[model samples]
Target: MNINDLPAEMLIEIFTYLPEWDFLRNARHVCQIWKLISTSPILRQNVELSKYMDSYAYPLKYFSAIQLYIKKLVMHSTYIQTFEKHHQDVKFENLKSLHITSKVQCTWWPNSVFNNFFSMFPNVQIIKITPEFWRDAENCLYALSQFSIIELDFGYYGSNSFGTMGKLHDLHYRFIQFVQCQRSLKILKIRASDHFAEDTVAQILEKCPTLTSLNISGAYVSAESFKISTNALALTEFYMKSQSEFKDGDLEALTKRAPCLKTLNIEGCRSITERGFRHIALNCSHLKKLFIGELDSNCVTDVGSDVITKIAKACPHLEFLSAIGCSKLEDDCIIDLTSSCGSLRGINLNGCTNITDVSFFALADHCPLLNVCEVRNSAISLKCAMYLIQHCKGLTKLNMSNCNNIDDKNDSELENMLETQSRNNKPRTNSSVNSKLDMSSFSMHCFHSHLKDLDLSESMHVTRTLATKLTRILPDLISLKLSISADIESDEEWFQEIFENCVCLSEFKLSTTTIQRQDYLKL
Candidate 1:
């Protein structure tokens, strides 16, 4: 059947499959029949498009192709003026998302200029305004409150005057009062200069009862005195980073209040203690992931252990736990963890230096279903780590960083699965059915094919041959952390070769002082 013969609904279905920009452009060019169907009010209600403009070759040709796919477009400072060069008969009503950020800061942008910029898209529902231009058009933000916005990322990049207590208070109060109170604001991301305004945040949560995701990263949460009692009944995800103000009882009270929280991350909240963790484990039963780092020394003691142990027993569904830098943990506490919460899927014991090989073996014996383990800085040698890996066949991710004993030989046998092409030759099939796979041997690359992420940082004995073997065998390797190592320097070229061949890598970290950014960026 011809395109014109299809029904509006069928055409929309086809068009929706096309990206936002392409769909709009394709619809506009078709006969009036297709245009009407594609441009109908119904089709425009829920769709969003983001068109990118970068300084590559063929600006005109690129813009033409992009204009066809452009639903919402972002223009950097350099590209803003150039967009008009490729201007066509496109309507402002067709656009849905717009972001304008520049490298150079603008002092002042008049209200008319700002209005005209957004006037291009009357149906805008998502907007991101950077601090680079916030000063120029602070009042422009007041106009944004009118849109049907559901997602907003507002940045305020000003000089750091967060030293004095009085200055911080005033800065906090000003922005808190300035945030446009929108009932429809469901996802809000803000970068503040000083501590987050507890009262203001509370007000925001109270107003937006439907808010599901909140990210307040790199901010001092002075809500120490201001109790964080969430009114966001629909809130599911909350991330608070660098919460320097989360002293002692603050986090404990906050978690107790957020009973329905599914994901709570207070990364770098140094003030949080065992009391806070205990509070969360007890109250937030639905928490799927909890990342509490930089706990105080006192809280890592026996008192903290008792609280967390109770929490582990109470919260039966805890899956991912990142208690990094909690040095108070001993084998006893780990034993309690395995016994109490046997259902754990992933655990990160990055800086729990007290944990030995014995502690991990205990975990391996108890938590058979554990798929991922990150024990970066502990007493577990390559020998004990290999044992744990052999037992936990289901594991795909492992971390043995700072464990000085993880030599090249010890690493190979830990994960040594074979990856072979299927009958079709195009597809690869991995098998654990081989009988010759020795579990008793202490080899580093024992089950290599099944291994996805491996951290052997500070394992000084790692050589070029071992690194190459790892990359060749482990086709699914996603992350490899080998920082502060002696072997990395000896075979720098081999390191490069491995990274180049490991096509599936998404995250990587190296601590060599000599490696350049271009070298790592090749991955």
Candidate 2:
């Protein structure tokens, strides 16, 4: 199939995957037809001015062509000239998403600039604003309410002129009024620590019932007064962290309101108890991701896990579960979890010392889809580790760092099997199985081979010989996290073996605790 003979639609689709500048500079210059497809408004919908901030890599006329197709304008003060009103009549007809941010503060953008910016994109559906830019939020809110905004991320870093009770109330009233007006609003993220906006947030939730995801972790949420009587069935993801207000009953009530929730993270709620966990396990049966890790104390102990199995039984579709430092859990609770939630992909049981080899046996027997398993500081032994590797063939990540019983004997066998595979065939590459992988980010992409990610950091029994052997075998290793082995405390030869054999590694995290100073120099 000649490249020139390919249909225009296919060529356009291929061009969309190329980097923005590469498309304009290389692919577009291929031919006249390619240039037309490259400059299409659909392809240029997400217009970011940040790349053009540092240097004038392209001509002014090139940007003029881009201005016509630009739909989502991302502005940074560093790139202020890129968004200037040179083409005042440019109607930005397809504009939907607008974000203005500054990593380094320049002169505060006045309300006049805000008014002009809003006027330019009258059809925006997404707005990400550094709230400090708006001198008077009331007028800006009124203008935003008139637009068809469905998502808003407000990072408010202005002076607290609303510190006084009366001014704060008026500000809250305006924000709630704006929230109510946006009938199609679905995602809202607010970042302002001062002025606990519990009542205002409650009012917004009550008014904009269509909101699906709400993140207010950057703001203080008054849990004492916040109540939700009406069920927002559409709301699925909610996060409110670092708060003392979430009592046992509040989360259960919130879950009852948003029963279809898929992801819920209340990691900073200090007052949450076993009852709240039980409520979530019972009510939110559709939950796919749940995070209930606490900082101050263990919220869900053994007693909680007993009731939390209701989650495993009810939500068998659960994919990700994290309950760090919840040590009261025993083997049966984990057994119930592995037996019920067979679709579980990743689980973190760090600091859960009560669990033994029986849990691993259950995981090996039931969970075939499991990929990542972290059981740091657990009681899993070498025999059980071998059993797990034998059964769970699909596991790409297994972190047994503090499971001190995991010695070099069984892992030596893995090294042998890997050597056998490598000796029989060409070195494994990502292209071998790229179709099943997610290539959105190079780092996130899997190596597409057996045992892509491995961590044996704290397991002191990993000998220098086995380490070198495994490196030669696992040719497609994308990540290898390791600690200095007890016997091979500082072997530069062992480290060299990895670089020599594992050419495909993209991430290598090491802890050089036991390496001698001179040994480090040798490395």
Q: Which stretches of candidate 1 lie over 4 Å from their true place?
A: 1-77, 80-104, 160-181, 195-198, 224-232, 295-303, 339-343, 362-372, 387-396, 408-448, 463-475, 478-523
| Model 2 pairs whose backbones collide | none
Model 2 lDDT at residue 228? 50
Best by TM-score: 2
Evaluate model 1: give its lDDT: 0.61
TM-score of candidate 2 versus the correct structure, residues matched by position = 0.77
Cα deviation of 166, candidate 1, in Å: 13
The alpha-carbon deviation from the true structure for residue 285 of candidate 1, after best TM-score superposition, in angstroms, is 0.8
lDDT of 2 by residue, 171-211 (tens): 67888888888888999988775543567677777888889
Residue lDDT tens for model 1, 342-431: 777888887777878877888778887778888766777665765676567667888776776566665535334332212112322244
